[model samples]
Target: MDIDWPLLTGLIGLCGVGLLLAYSASGGDARALHSQGARILISLLLLGVASQVPAPWLHRLAAPAYLLTVLLLVLVEAIGAIGQGAQRWLELGPLRFQPSELAKLAVPMMVARYLSDRPLPPTLRDVAASAALALLPVVLIAAQPDLGTALLVTAAGMSVLFLAGLGWRLIGLFGALAAATAPLLWFYGMRDYQRQRVLTLFDPERDPLGSGYHIIQSKIAIGSGGFYGKGWLEGTQTRLHFLPESATDFVFAVFGEEFGLLGAIGLLLLYGFIIGRAMHIASQASDGYGRLLGGGLVCTFFVYVLVNIGMVSGILPVVGVPLPLVSYGGTSMVTLMLGFGMLMSIRGHRKLWPA
Candidate 1:
């Protein structure tokens, strides 16, 4: 097994925390625990398989994988299962998975492969081409009305650009352009509920029992935990069902409420270590493809943690981003673990491939 021990250990630790939180959040439901456990095992299996694959193979599959994912996204738009008021999943009989989850890996992989053979600090033409590659799927996903996943996919592709030595001036210009279009996006791009969510972030109390309910309850649950938490299964908010999405997006709040500040910090430290280790692997990769792909995947993973923690902690709008391994979900677990697997592959195969 050519595994990266530190990274794998951190992942397993987070998964364990997830199981603990899931059990508590579900009020000790055996079925929920079993299902989540099964998913974790499957995700780990995929990670193991991915880690064994060579970097060159990943480089070869990048374009095809990306194209297939985009095709799936289009299929999602045409004939997809609608869940939670969004068309994001594609159900093939007993198998139901989110194509957008695949985008998280595909977009970055495709971008990294494209830029690898090109010059560093990609020229205007190259940047435009890369942006098109990213935007195509992003547009398709946004049309699915899955703004969260769309934004995440965008971030994943942008990370590749950033890692490819994209200039600071270009980045600043892009930032300014995004800012300038914020109003247009607000008025024309955002749905009513999405706008409400953003507004609720500033004043969650405004809707109290309505639009603000989730964040407001999450804040109370987290705040009541104080420094040492209320202890496992003793969380009033979770036990009494005051908290919503306790087993999914808001699971972190349940964790904070049960385990307190110390546990939260410990969990974050574990996450930090995994991210740091992945970055170190990326830094040591002998090829541009390996470096960009590894770095981009890790950056996307960082954003996942940031957005989920930010939303649950009342710092950002609730965009339905799960708390990585700790949140109870299947596709997300698989996608993230697969990314880690690819990182391990990059590290494990460094000596075999020349720069």
Candidate 2:
């Protein structure tokens, strides 16, 4: 059977743009550009391999894979490298990996597998059971203080349970409880610097040279791009080093400053197509498992795009979300490819097995 070329092509196109933007964003740092080129090649190779794997195999491995990631997360906390006030990465000689990215796929896979044939309109017992499965990793990651990824992973897992028929009354109750507890989570749950990030989202002018500077400068860079950007590598905000996190969390600002609104909108449109196609695949899947797995993966993919762009453009508070395949990181690329692989796995094997 022929693979769905559009989804594959769309992902490749997004990554290609990411490489170009990464190059321009880095101010001709030859090392970064060369490294990005190599990473892209590796990512493509992984994508190809993942595309051929079976969904059942992926489902089978979910529990073990997720447990491994959790163990690594806990291990990282115990003896991980500390950077920027958080222990989020595990050093691999020349590489730094984040287990949280792996959790993005693992958590959803485990949940989809769990709820595959459970009764619709879940019982409180099911909801409680599912919540336990979902929150274990969330609590661990949050302890690393990577709130951005922790939240995204939670959303992905909850999406599956929602598909499994989590009660709306329960959802609303959750919403209210989350809102009420947000204050305590804010004042006590968040570190001082994290609290600063939320405050920076509002009045960036308060600390023009501190936590607020990143957002303020990002806005300036995006605004300066206007209709036709400053031209690749010519972005003053990034090339001149005004925009912090230019190559990572704030990568979107660099893209806008160099590629302009047209480029920005074009990028958004590409994401729209990729996500739309994933949703289409989910809808067409043969069974409850296939459908929930595909749909939940789609939501996870969309969150990667949304959080990166939103945080960079100042729409959402700054979160350390990478731009899926675009951002520079091993774990993000691996997790993203795994998600795409699941999509491919679902599409590739559906014809052979009965739902």
Candidate 3:
């Protein structure tokens, strides 16, 4: 089998956890479990198909895929469905999906493709071009006010540049520039509620029933779990519906409240193993494009996990990043699984690529 079993096993384990938690969070709602299960199956199937695609094919498709995704994003801006106070999703007849999710893959693919043909440690011009490719969709997504996806897309593209051996001096310079623009983004780019989320992070009690409600409840649930947890389906916060978005963004809190500290450690270890295996695969790539794409995808996945856990634990401001493979969402699940499939493709097709 061309499949990387350890990575596959780790992914399956997380999906299983998701199903379990979803069942509990929905208060044993069979429809919710079935819906999530169907999406997982579809995503896994796509992963299988994506794993069989050759590297050259992936490289060949990068530009067109990216262009098409960008176009879709534009279409979204014009006619996208409004949901949850944001115009982020597009509905085409029977289908409804977020173009921002596709941007997560497309931006990195485009960046890796551009950088692979250039010299190692790209020149300023090359870096500028790659950043442009990245920022185009980022600007569009951010305009949709999907700040979380915008940040992830930015991370996705930037990870490719970093993997291409962008220098420490340039990294430092850009970091400073970003810091300098932070206040501008806060004042000009952020919406009112977005600003409130940041403020709520410091003192959730400031708006306990408003912007702070989500994180505050999340913290209480996680803290109540203690060492051994309250036990499966026995989570008081979840059972009583005190935790908001229990099946989606804040699902980790429900997990903590039920499974405790030990379960959380186990979950993190599983994530670590998957990340370690994927990085190893990336390291073994036969060509620069493979390395860049694989590494960038892995880094994006890492950020997804980090941000979700951090937000749930009340350590970071809630930016609405879902836990990879665990959060109950079709678009995020499909996007992540597709990236993993590409990682598997890099591993499977390495020897076939030209040196």
Candidate 4:
């Protein structure tokens, strides 16, 4: 099978930059650097294997796989391990996993399967039902209080719905309703920390040294990076432990501290290339399932980039969103690579059978 070199090249480029940023962010710490290196190597292998799986296989397994993912999520809640104040993972002997990662794949499968070739302009009922289906996993995820991942999964589902020709008036009305509900959700539905994030976002100096510290320091770090940065390992904000989650959610701040605007712009361009290739592959898909899966994955990936930069820049409240390909997490990497692999498989084997 022919490989789409552009996708592979883009992935490689991202992994390469991720490694450098990870290493530098750790202030030259050997263990963190090596651990990140190991993740990159493993991700490369996963990407290769994922690229090899035939699209037909993914299509056939779509329903069962989605059901399996839901079951896994249930199992996680029932008898799962807890970490960082959230019961969002399952612990095996040597493998701990987040089932929500599974939703990234499953949600797209279900949506694509539902909307594929139904009709160009879906009725109001169809749209409402699809919206409900999209929100199901999103609500389950927010219960974990992992707002970042939930938002990305929501984007994945919405991409499919949007591709199904959702009308603008409905979207506008939904936005208006969301705006109307924001207050009620804040008072009745949100947790204390979540609300404080929004409050702190508006005026971080209110509690400049406590809960607000992260956003303030992150902004400081990005500005500290200046036009050319402090020359890599010379960043004071990260090395001093001022920015929270420096290895993960706040990696972009560290990235800014070391790379400056030029590097930041370069990183954005890389993301653009990755998303562009994903869309190109989605366009090449031979079936509706492939189209939905491929398109949904690319859109989800775009959400990661946008959310991370937005939160870090203080335009949006901090929401635990990790900068894609740069954050230090095995689960996020695995899920992302899995998506790319499926995209590659769809592109490579678009024809030649039950696709």
Candidate 5:
């Protein structure tokens, strides 16, 4: 199988950096680091398997994959395990996994499948059908009260639409509609805790010991890091356990506090390179499905980085979005690797004309 070495290199670099930061954030404990290592190995194996699958098979499987995920989401509401005050997980004997993560992959696949054969710019009916395919998963996810995952899943499908020749006017209209509905979302759609998060974004100090604690501590950790940082394993906020979710959602704060501003920029540059490579692959895609799937995955990856960093830096409300490939989590890592593997599948399975 053909390999995209630069993309793999970027992924490996991020995973390695993630391990180090996770270890540091754990106060020299090797448990999280070790778990991350195992996850990386498994993720790579999955990537290999996915890379060998033909694009046509993926296209054919899209409908079934999406339908299965939809069923899982419904099951989640019925009998799923609850954690962090949300029913987002399915428990089966010894295995537990989030159905919402499946939507991340399936939504894009189905959107691409729908638009691959249809001529675009899509007609109004086509747009409505695509929206139904996308919104069904998004609405189900929001019902679980997992806003971050919901938004990401929605973006995955929207990215496909955007790449499928959605018009600029439609884009602007959607943007305006979303803005107009923001207040309604805040009042009726969002949970009380979620609303508090938004309010805290403007002034975290107002409730330093309540809903605002996380961002407040995050800002402290980041700002405390000077030019070259306080040195690895020397981040006071993380070591002292003052930072919340340091090894997961706020791992960037651990990185910043220890490596400083320069290191943060370097991390961003690494992510930028990864996204750039994905976009390049998308540009070279052999079909509409490949193009839309690749571009959507890349866009979703961009949002992961943007949301995680934005929340940590106090620029956006605190959401439980983990740093892509850099945060400690098995599900997120595997979900992302699946996308990358599909990307490689497209690249490797393309028909090459004789010179």
Candidate 6:
């Protein structure tokens, strides 16, 4: 099968940069660097395996995958492991995993499958059903109090709806409805800490040592890094432990602290190339399933980049969103690579099927 050379090249570059950033963030800790390296290797292997799987196989599995993930999310609520004050994972025997991560891919696939051949500008009923399909897991995940993952999953589902030709009038209507529900959601749905985050975005200094600490520190780290940065492993905020989650959620701040504005822009450009290539592949897909799935995945990937950067730069609330592959998270890296692999499968399968 033909390979997507540009996408692969962009991934390699990002992976390299991720390694460097992780190593520096860990303060020359070889163990952390090695662990990240191992995950990247595994992620690359999965990407290859996913790329090899035929689109027909993925299409057939879409519904089952979505159902299984929903079940797992329920299971998480029932018997999931708790970490960082949230019950978002299940531990069975020696294995522990986050079911919400599964929804990131499953929700999009199922949405695309449901909407693939549906009439364009779907009726109100169809839109509601699709929203239910997407938001069902979102509700379960929000119960996990993992608002970040829930938002990401919703974004992935919405990407499919948008690509499937959901009309602007309906989109505007939904937006208005969501806006109307914002207050109810804030008071009844969002956790106290989540609300604090929203509030903290406006004035992080209001609680500089409390709910706002993360944004405050993150901003300091980013701002402290001038044009070329403070140089690798020399970021005072990170090395001194002033920055929280330096290896994960705030890795961008660590990167910005060490590499400066130029490095940050370069990283954004790299992500831009990756997203562009994925969307291009999506456009070239041979079938509706392939096109919608590819496009949904690309759009979801874009959300990850946007939210993470926005949060770190203090323009948006901190929602525990990681900086895509660059952040030190195995689950996210693997999930992202799996999406890329599926994109490759969609692109490569097109020539043979030509449907």
Please give each candidate's TM-score: 0.99, 0.95, 0.99, 0.95, 0.97, 0.98
Could you give candidate 2's per-residue lDDT for residues 214-328 as a string of tens digits?
Answer: 8899899999999989888889987778888788888888888888999989989999999999889887877777888888888888887888888888888887888877776
lDDT for 147 in candidate 2 is 90
lDDT of 2 at 239: 71
Report model 2's TM-score to 2 decimal places. 0.95
As a TM-score, model 4 comes out at 0.95
Compose the digit string of candidate 3's lDDT tens values, residues 1-355. Answer: 4999989999999999999998999999999899999989999999999999997788888999999999999998999999988999999899898988998889989999999998888999999999999999999999888889998999999999999999999999999999999999999989998898899889999878988899989999999999999999999999998999999999999999999999999999999999999999999999999999999999999999999999999889899899899988788999999999999999999999888
Q: Residues 1-355, candidate 5: write the lDDT tens digits.
A: 7879999999999999989987898888889889889999999889888988987788888999999999999999999999988999999999999999999999999998898879888876787799899999999999998999998998899988988888998889889989999989988999889989999999999999998899999989999998889999999999889998999999999999899999989998999999999899987877877888889889999999989999999999887899999898899999999999989888888673111
Clashing pairs in 3: none
Q: For each candidate in turn, give its C-alpha RMSD to the true structure in angstroms.
A: 0.8, 1.7, 0.9, 1.6, 1.7, 1.1
Once model 5 is optimally superposed onto the true structure by TM-score, how far is the C-alpha of residue 318 displaced, in angstroms? 1.3
Residue-by-residue lDDT tens digits, candidate 4, 1-355: 5678888888888877778778777777788878888887887788789888877888777779777877887787688788999989888999888888888888887787777747756678877877777787778777876787788888998888877778999889878989999989989988998899988989988999987898899999999999888877878998888888888888888888888988888888999998998898998887877887788889889988899999988989888878888887677887898888888888888885364
Backbone collisions counted per model:
0, 0, 0, 0, 0, 0
What tens-digit string does per-residue lDDT give for candidate 1 at 1-355? 7998888998999999999988999999988889999999999999999999987999999999999999999999999999888998899999999898899999999999999989898997888899999999999999889888888999999999998999998999989999999999999999999999999999999999999999999999998998999999999999999899999999999989998999889989999998999999999999999999999999999999999999999999999899999999788999999999999999999998776
Candidate 6: list runs displaced more than 4 Å: none
Candidate 4 lDDT at 337 equals: 88
